[model samples]
Target: MINEPSAPTATHEFDLTTAPIESFTALQEARQEVFSSERAHDAFQRTIRGLQPTGPEGLRRGLGAWMIGDYEGACDALSAYASDDVASFTHANALMTLKRYVEAQPIFKRLAEKYPGEPKAQGGYAEACFEAALSEHGEHEIDAICEVYERELAAAGEGFADSAEGQYLAGRAAEVRRDWQLALDHFGKARELNPAMRRNLFHLGLRAERCGLDLEALVAYQQLASLAPVDLPAMMNLGMLLEDLGRDQEAAACYDVIARSRPMDRRARLYLSDAVAGMDMYYDEDQERKEDRLNQILRIPITDFELSVRARNCLNKMNIMTLGDLVKQTETELLSFKNFGETSLNEIKEILGSKSLRLGMGRQEAVLSIESTQQRYVSGENAEAMNRPILDLELSIRARRTVEYLGCLTFGDVIQHSEEELLGMPNFGVTSLTELKEKLTIFGLELKPRQ
Candidate 1:
């Protein structure tokens, strides 16, 4: 045994002068194993332990750590030996993973300049700078960063251009510019390239929703929810989409799960209550019949009423088409018009009385509604300004449809109803409800609270 131990084998020695090529080859092998090995972290640790601490070998170890998602270890190893271009690039990447974008930008920029042919360097520099610009930078800085990102992306060549991550970055850039269609297209391409990219999926959902592609948004959110079941934002967004599509029970289940999971969360609790109320407020057969009859009554022409020629002519000249419109006018308003006297008023009252209605029956209610709406906007000196038209709010089509459906021609008509009443509309959902609330909030108003 002592004789056998006389000569130590080359493998048994910790040689500091190991060839750089051998270390590079070993690192390549380890990198492949990381993508396929079950014990990838252990493999990386073993490979890193055998490398020298201050050369290409150290850079390999750092890259291995990064490959295995050990960002802290990658930073420590790379920072110690980041003199060359490759080491510096890896160090900047580790910094990005650590969310140190401010510190990572300059290094990435330097590396990109040093190795203009490296796609990773160019892309990393663009991403780092873009992130830095987003975190409270001025518009000029954002514009400059965007220009740099676009230039680097173009220089990265066709291979990187067609890559999944490349498309994701493009989508983010388009999103910042408010180009919804372009963002959606790029995000879709990224997802097709890598179906497991949940970040891209989330962004795709947002873009789809913004573009009014409800089915696409629903599918994207569903896929993201499956990928990340406990993600609160995804869950909430999914619930909102479901509610918008009239799937109240499903939406309620979603809110209930979140509320139960986080009992102390006020937003979750409020959403749960809203979902339950929405479910309970579904239209019944009786309500449907009542709405149909009401609509029919509103469409009745004034010509159907039996009246003298003079009264009929006066009503025609006044543009009073329906019984509904006539009931909305006061006797004083009608008499103030030329050739509209007490005789014509008596005739109009007889016709309305036959239908169990009265002139100006809605006046008092209208006054109260307007006063209530004005009160909501009177924080200081904005009372008179609040009497503006609902059109001035510039709401989305969906929200505008909801308001028009409720006959809300003015801001006064809008504030007369509570949240429950608005949600009770057959076609109105959580999306329209939220949109209307946000528009009202801009004018220092909100939906009337539930009593």
Candidate 2:
């Protein structure tokens, strides 16, 4: 780590625009001192603004502007110095900041070829090519440029492996070639080398997700999202992963950032609303606890209760080994069993009566007698819509979770269930039902209606 260098003691010596740098070392030291702190930068900016330098007007003023974080001024001043190598390089760097990748590419390429031994020139050219490869309408030969990128990267070899930027360029080339695995590997290595590189972290998260590395993707996105000036893509992916992991509160926070930033993003808005609703969702713990105790009682072994040998033998033959199974049998069914006479029946009836249960009660409660009011599966007028994936509905979280839990991969499976059946799911509510109904309405479909 370089120590912070102190600013000049004299005000006159601080003017970067006028001071003729004596040597490479002096220029480097002066640049370091100027950038050491915000106060120093501001002071340098003020001094640079007040001086008239003796040199190529654009080169002197533009170089000073570039150093003090004034890209617009640098670009304006350097616009006329196309023939100067330093001006061309600085101009290309500023153009990159303004997202003029095509304009920057040739400039950096020229500089890289002219100064083959300079790592900075080569790195800049590689970056421009990578950015160009990513643009949808690149206005350049993306494949050709990617090939060039690969050649440069390969020439650097393991020497470049020691650099985060070199590995990142390799990943970008691999991505451009649709080599997902190689891209993932390079991006992962780049992230390990420099965790602070936002683009590297973003690509690492994306590649990890595509390769099914859920936990690693989650961590990568989390780190990127935590950094300043929130990255929209990172936030979106983090929210999705968090939602899938059932971290609704954290997921809501992520979606909320995107939703607030880009109000017109419908997907992000929907996700935010769903996550917030999930955070407020109700779970009937009391009802679940009561059902749990009831299930325990029902699961008790029939043999644990008092019974005549004949009764026990009859139950054993019928495979009615538990109180739950015994309850599922009606009197008529039990009577049909050979050797199960009145005394055995009376004894069984008495035992169940003591527990306030009757024969066939479990079966009665377990069966769904209501039939679908319409055809539930694909085969008719709405068959095409029914055959579509559940994702077509763009459902809110609770509804989607319930259907997914029920193994509904297509709308057909979802339509097979009644509104009450869906509402019975944990966290699924009337609002989700209404939202679902609205979406289905678009395709002229609805949940199976109950009679």
Best by lDDT: 2
Candidate 1's displacement at residue 424, Å, is 45
Best by TM-score: 2
Model 2 score (lDDT): 0.69
Clashes of 2: 0
Where model 2 places Cα greater than 4 Å from the true spot, the runs are 1-99, 110-120, 133-146, 156-158, 262-267, 281-451
- In model 1, where is the ten-residue run with the lowest total lDDT? 1-10
Once all C-alphas are superposed, what RMSD does model 1 give against the true structure? 27.7
* TM-score of candidate 2 against the unseen true structure: 0.42
Candidate 2 displacement at residue 68 in angstroms: 14
> Tens digit of lDDT per residue, candidate 1, span 1-451?
0001123222111222242323222333334334322233354467667877667777766766665557788788888764665556667766886778887888877876776655556667778877777875756566666777777677777687787768888988888877788999999999998775656888899889878998899878877764422446777888888788765545765676578767897887787677767764443432343333344345567887788898888888989988779877766689898888888888888876655455655533222222222222323344533545566778787777667666564565688789899888867889888888888887777667789
**Which residue window of length 10 is worst by lDDT in model 2?**
366-375
For all predicted structures, in order, the TM-scores are 0.40, 0.42
- Candidate 1 collision pairs: none
How well does model 1 score by local distance difference test? 0.66
